[model samples]
Target: MEPIPNPSSAHPITEERPGEAPIFDWDWTETLAQSWETLLLILSTFWCILLARVVTQKLQLHDSPNLCYAVEFGLVILPCILLITVAVDYSNYIGFVMFSGTLWFLRKNRVLERARTRGQFDLGGNRHMALSVLRALTHLITAINILAIDFGSYYRPYRKSLQFGAKLMDTGIGLFVFTMAMVSRRTHNWSDLRRIAVYSVLPLILLGLARSATVLVLGYGQDIHEYGQHLNAFFTLVFTKFFGALLNILARKDLHLLPLGFGILLIHQFGLSFLGVSDYVMNDDVDRTNFFNANREGLVSLPGFVGLYGLSIYVNRWMVASSLLSYSELVRKLRRLLLVVLLLWSLFVISAYGIGISRMTCNLGYVIWMLAIGSTSLWASFGAIDFVINSVMPWESSPSDEQEKGLVTRGTVAKGGDKSIVSFTISQALNQNGLTFFVVANVLNGAVNKFLRPEDRSNCESVIILLVYMFLGTRMAYELLKRGIRLA
Candidate 1:
């Protein structure tokens, strides 16, 4: 063997070469995995908004005026604290710095405006000035926290700061609730409540839809850097859209919907808790992952969150129909049975899609999961609202004289000469129908992403099919929206 060198042995011959090729160094930080932290951070931020809104609505219903003010204050203050803490630990100080700069600019601009408007400038808006000052202080604290989080190599150094920030935020939130309770005792107006409800709920629905879309689009193509950019863009877009919708809703004073929405939310929470117990026993492995990430581990995984959310919504819908609805016992039982069946069916669909199709792709299952979760949530929410409205405010005809005069009663559809009834009926029907279709589209979208990707057990043909389905769904949504607008 030594006498005759084996031709197959390329290693020995290559070793005799003068120099070895240089190995390219790869940085994990440049990859998508590293950006998971950013995604989690953004998710937490969104949760803050959701919590604030939910709490605000709850307080509003109790007629607590001071509580509302407190909630608003807490909403601004608490997040600033948490964000500051996280920023400090993660060395992400930009948010705090930008916030401070914004305050300074606003103050200067206010002075200039006052000077121009009046001969002598007077910043005598003491309350407003105090609030601004508080905001500045919060901003400064947040900036410090950001620096600590982003730059702190060791967690120990920032642990105290983190705890302190959380405590401050919590205390601020508590104060806000207390204030709202005090204020609610003095206010009572049903019409105003209704207006608030409509405005808040509608905008939330739209904002949720937009955010879900942004997540799906951004999660596509498996490019880490692009993914980060998309995540940032999604946050920015969500903030803008939510605030715009909230402003519009506020202008209309449609606050009454808060109670109904809060009720639905409470139902949703109960459903989620039930699902958690069921999932723990039935899907131990998945449960293990979810628990590890959500509880034991600090990392927040999107799929785990969606899966839990979807289960919660499905459960909530059942609860609303069976427990909350004013149906006969038999009807309630039947509805419960049907809900269980649907829940099982949805689970089957998701599992099959995941195992049979999603194994091939990097994050396709997650994308589909998010879409499905969004759709289910919207459907359940709307359905709950419908059920509550019908139960509490059943359609009733007016007295003979009122009816003859062609006046439209609160829940009654007007006849012949009045088009309001027809319009109202059409709008409600279209909205409900549109929501159902939207849920179906979400499920289908998930299926496509799971089974149609090239990495999945499919070729380009799968993608084509998926695209066609999406196109059809989009067209349907557009038509529904048009009908809705006409009715409105």
Candidate 2:
């Protein structure tokens, strides 16, 4: 998923010409009053975790671990379900509570608590499962946001009553990808870098070139994206993310990665500005509307995203470099996280007010704003959720406890985790299997567009279609799991 999609960005949706020019509203990113609801939602999400956790822990007389897991999962997932179903203004609030709470809950048991202080992050309880669950949730939410709406109108989306808020998938992907990357850190060696390059980056680059050729040569995506920028997200992963890691490995300077990347970005920004590629020359409607793959957007924006990728490494290094032993220790760590958030927020405010917020250029202000908001939300949401999970379920249930209670047995997953249709059924399907679902989803979406043509369908029909697609994807994941198949 390319972050901050332009109206005309590549991604096949039912095409409908607008009577009037479509408006791109971004006031909430600037004004405090307009953005008040979102800020409050962030707070409300954290509060939801606290209240749910505390209440659940206090009423834990059920004396059944399975019952407790079921109850906890329900309490956390309910708000998210409401948000996704209703859409509109409430989406961000519930989405935040859901992901952030689950993230914290997962972090309750540290796999490498002592190593964390020395700059290592090893989480307990089937990390692959955790990552899969989060990615699946992200994909699921994005699917609902895009597919379940009316294709008649970009905003209206035929029959849907509420529009999804921007804050949902726009920022969610960044956090999860970074979380995934951070968990799998420490491959600065050349052999490992080359292995990733051959196995992942090169394949992605080729896929991107093929996708780009669909537009540039065959004229598939000529309506929305430009020839150059029409290359798919695989290009983003290969060029922006993997390219950065390759640079670090070549330089053999892992510690100084972000600073170096930032410097490179600064040079690119100024170089683009000097070459008439800046806002001065390309301020026209065609340029703004068809910003994808534009020379400025397609080429120049790479450094910005790469800078963000580099910064994620640095941020994750600091984040997982330490761990908590007690509630009081968590409180201290949280305060530190908040302090960093405040400082970053100050920088974001300065950048937005001083320069401006431009998603097109992947401007410095926009990047800072993303980090500031993402870090605070992740920290606060995760900490609170972890607290509650720890209170309800022991981080490591003893063999005796499991044997006596006949509960969720030790190390259920031989490779991943328990295959039972338990409390985390949907998440388990997705856990460590998000990519397969994503690829399946895209292929199926294209097939749907070809056959069903969602643009012609009514809103009710579209929603039903979306449900079918989702069910199909989930079933695919489940069957794969049963057969011990995985798409990493």
lDDT scores for all predictions?
Answer: 0.30, 0.48
Tell me how far the alpha carbon of residue 20 in candidate 2 is from the true structure, in angstroms, after superposition.
Answer: 27
Tens digits of lDDT, candidate 2, 195-281: 877766676676566545543543323212211335445565567657667655654555686677677667755654455444432
Judging by lDDT against the true structure, name the best candidate. Answer: 2
What lDDT is reached at residue 6 by model 2?
46
Error of model 2, residue 84, in angstroms: 6.1
Error of 2 at 273 (Å): 5.7
| Candidate 1: tens digits of C-alpha lDDT, residues 1-488 | 01222332211111222343222112222212222332233333333433443344434323232343345335533443344332325424444554465356446545333323332211122111112222222222322232222222212222221101111111121111111111111112455445534643354455446545744764433222211222322232233223323332333232332333334334433432334421222221333333332231111222222222223323333333332222344244445545654564454245333321111111222223323332332233232223322222222233434224322122333222322221121122223233333344444544444454423332234324433553454344334443333211
The local distance difference test score of model 1 is: 0.30
Residue pairs whose backbone atoms clash in candidate 2? 116-321, 132-431, 132-432, 133-431, 150-157, 150-158, 159-459, 229-293, 413-417
TM-score of each: 0.21, 0.65
- Candidate 1 residue spans exceeding 4 A from truth: 1-364, 383-488
Query: Which ranges of candidate 2 are over 4 A from the true structure?
Result: 1-122, 125-136, 148-180, 206-229, 250-255, 268-276, 280-296, 322-327, 395-425
Best by TM-score: 2
- Write down the worst ten-residue block by lDDT for model 2: 157-166
Candidate 1, residue 104: Cα displacement in angstroms equals 46
